[model samples]
Target: MFLFYQRSVHTWFFLCNFSSRKWWNEETVAVVTGGNKGIGFGVCKQFSIAGLRVVLTARDADRGQEAHQKLKHEGFQNISFHQLDVTDAASRTSFAPWLLREHGGFNILVNNAAINGVAIDEVYSKENNISLKDFLVCIS
Candidate 1:
């Protein structure tokens, strides 16, 4: 698992070359959190195209379903959607049982869920002769 945080979104990517693995089949499930948009959505699409069953999860059900529909419209039928707020205990606890029952548990997990915990101080950074890149490097 590799996590990259940028612009308040935590983008997670499973860092294995799936194409090289013969065991990765249609029944193999990949769960992607924050799959409503951006890197998460792209990961979902790639996994779907690669013939793996993909569970696209988001904190917002409406957005998650919309993304699932978009993938379906693009002719990818292997994608499914479930609402998951990783920050909430109830949501996190319920998801495991649901995933086990629905897809026999997942083989891959992309932990792309995040909350905006950072507020950039551009003025302060400038005054201190700090570049945005330098600030990000320091924080991360």
Candidate 2:
């Protein structure tokens, strides 16, 4: 049985019971968006540890390269950095060709890029020291 749980707006927990089989190798490439920090970075690290070629993409070139360097310095060799802004049409259009030309196309894509859209009341949140959900509940 396969179980999928929605942990939050930005995270999912997956559990699966299936026959153990190998499906990927060093050539299997995974592209992770917003991989310069947080959950994205963690995903990139895990994929690298699993021996898959990881393309760690971020909107910021400097941050992305820094993340890539950090991984490499830690002895991860199957990783690369690429700049990708998922919100921009031009950037997306150009990235596809570059990816194909350089890596022959990717096998997996983690669409992890995100921006928090909720406008929080900073003063109220700080004074109350409440979570976002709690703040929303109090206001509403």
Candidate 3:
């Protein structure tokens, strides 16, 4: 049960391993949030290539479908797509049951959707001596 944050192209991901059992591609069902691009996209690709049935999710429908198509076009049959917004509570509530029903079982979840708190202008940020925590506040 290890957790790590994978950062890519200014996007942050919360990745967790759900179980101790090793993953087998044919037997595994993986859900990767924000799979339209960056780390999420790469995760989807790797999982599909490994023979796992991967559900690639993105907040944008068009983007998600496009990413799905890109993988399919690349000749991977084990990958699929769904629209998801990880920040939304209602969406989260709906997605869980649907995944269980549709996929039969889930073996992995890669939560790659994220919110970033950083200035786009590196020079200005440096000049102002702003740290990352200036944008991210601890909930507790």
Candidate 4:
């Protein structure tokens, strides 16, 4: 019983040391798309504060660069900028390779880019008894 107890303690010690070594040496990288402003920018700031290397991307180069500089000026040196237009395949292909080359690997990717549109006529028509499909089609 004493031998068995000693073995268990040794095993636990070895596992703890191994896990600690693995975690201590690992670097985490993150990318936030549409991160120059709004929610994406907030996420980037949070990640940078959390010690992750963050790349904030936007469709406009100037905006992306400006955001990067702003974060840096704010003492978040781990943040950088990249131009990404998700709707364009060419842009995605170019950025993917660049990301892989620069960051070894990315542990996080925040896709916050979106489009919102609302039609007042569609809303009024729905209130006036239009079908759901028709309402959706009208909005589209």
Candidate 5:
């Protein structure tokens, strides 16, 4: 049996009982969107630890590259980075073909990208002693 857990607005994590080293091979691929930080990053880390070839993607190249570096520094070699903007139809439409051509095909996909749609000014947050992340966590 598998228990599905919701991680973020755009993410769902699946926990399965199946266990076998050969079940998922080196060719297994996973795409994680908005994986530069927070819950997406956590999901990417877990997938990498479980031996999936993780493609950690973000809209911003710099943040995605930073995450790739941090994961590499921590000794996770099964992970890589790509840039994707889920909200853009042009970007979304191109990803599948790109994945199919480059990695053959993907077995897992995690869509963890969403805009909070709130304008956060750091100065105001600091003055109130509540960060955007903290506020979101509290409200959720």
Candidate 6:
């Protein structure tokens, strides 16, 4: 099953699925932001491999296209690319209409895009000295 969270104004909707199933047919589609690298890239790769139509977005058009090509070269055909920057209002505005018209609505979303403030090894080395505020900021 999928759970959807629709923000005010009904501009964009976020969907999350907790099921263990692989592919749920074409009824399911996904849009993953910052999906050109790291965890976001991994999620897109797996979702595409599972047979879902995956739209992976990145701020850099070149990088996004390269990532899409890499995935296709690796045999992930259900994946595509789009330019997006979650922090930019213009990108968000443009994305809304495109998503609604292209996919109708997304059935899954992986907000895997995040900025790391500190190295994991360094954090573990000084666990007791790490302030709560700093820790929260790091994860945020």
Clash pairs, candidate 6, are none
Q: Which ten-residue region of model 2 has the weakest summed lDDT? A: 115-124
Error of 1 at 29 (Å): 0.5
Model 4 residue 124 distance off true place after TM-score fit, in angstroms: 26
lDDT of 6: 0.76
Candidate 1 vs. true structure, TM-score: 0.69
**Lowest lDDT block of 10, candidate 5:** 115-124
Ranking 3 against 6 by lDDT, winner = 3
Tens digit of lDDT per residue, candidate 2, span 1-140? 22243557654333336569767789999999999987788778777776789999999889999999998999988899889987667888988998998789999888888844432345555657667668799899
Best by lDDT: 1
- The runs of at least 3 residues in candidate 3 whose Cα sits more than 4 Å from the true structure, single-residue gaps closed, are 1-23, 116-140
Please provide, for model 4 over 1-140, each residue's C-alpha lDDT reduced to its tens digit, 9 standing for 90 to 100: 01111355332111222444434222788788999987788778877765778889998889889988988899998887889987667989999999989997688788886532355455667776757777888999
* TM-score ranking, best first: 2, 1, 5, 3, 6, 4
- Global Cα RMSD, each model: 10.6, 10.9, 9.9, 13.7, 12.2, 12.7
lDDT of 5 at 122: 45
Error of 6 at 20 (Å): 8.4
lDDT over C-alpha atoms for residue 22 of model 6: 46
lDDT string for model 1 (23-127, tens) is 678889999999989888988877886689999999999988988899899998999999999867799999999999999999999898766443234445565
lDDT of each: 0.83, 0.80, 0.77, 0.75, 0.79, 0.76
How does model 2 fare in lDDT? 0.80
Error of model 2, residue 27, in angstroms: 1.1
Every model's TM-score: 0.69, 0.70, 0.65, 0.64, 0.66, 0.64
Q: For model 2, which pairs clash?
A: none
Rank by lDDT (best first): 1, 2, 5, 3, 6, 4
Once superposed on the true structure, which residue ranges of model 1 sit more than 4 Å away at CA? 1-21, 118-140
What's the true lDDT of residue 124 in model 3? Answer: 55
Tell me the lDDT of candidate 1.
0.83
lDDT per residue, candidate 6, 53-80, as tens digits?
Answer: 9999998889999999999999998887
